[model samples]
Target: MLVEDEHSLHAINVGRRLLVQLIETCKELENIHRIYAYVESTNLDGIHFYTMMGFQRRETLPDYFPQRASLTPDAVKLVYEIGNDSSTEAIQTFPVTNQP
Candidate 1:
């Protein structure tokens, strides 16, 4: 699971490439199942990047980023499922907060 604010990195290509590399790197470590990301639906470059990386568009939350409507636009929930334990998709259920 990763949360990125596009406002910080307006460069679509950069984000795409970085994400791809991140996924690949993560896969080299543990067994990933599926990756979840929250992106503005109107982010064509972002959608294109995920699609190219073999990620399936899952759902769209109507009102996700009200402030990003005009600024961003495509506010949606993107889900990318790889395959079995060998999957490169990041696991989400792993809640790592603070303990001993």
Candidate 2:
């Protein structure tokens, strides 16, 4: 969920909305029980956002990202488990944003 560099969209809950929609879609599938996200270690904001959206840190992955000139070398694995009572209740509490 990459947002543009524009500051105006930064606090508009765009990322949260997209993530909730993705989770909702994933919950409809029978085989998908968990959602995993690998966020670069240096990206604290990204980590915080995912955690706020109910993803728990599973582990720190060494050299998870490719050795690209612009990419971080390490990452943290986050997981959100579905088909659970707590997760479903938490997901339902997130405010739904209207599509433009």
Give me the candidate number with maximum lDDT: 2
**Per-model CA lDDT versus the true structure:** 0.56, 0.67
**What is candidate 1's lDDT per residue for 1-100, written digit by digit as tens?**
3434445554556656766776776566657767766666666665665677776778876655545324443355666665547545564421111111
Error of 1 at 81 (Å): 2.2
lDDT of 1: 0.56
Q: What is the lDDT of residue 34 in candidate 2?
A: 72
Estimate the TM-score for candidate 2.
0.72
Model 1 regions more than 4 Å off: 1-13, 66-74, 84-100
Tell me the TM-score of each prediction against the true structure. 0.56, 0.72
What TM-score should be assigned to candidate 1?
A: 0.56
Best by TM-score: 2
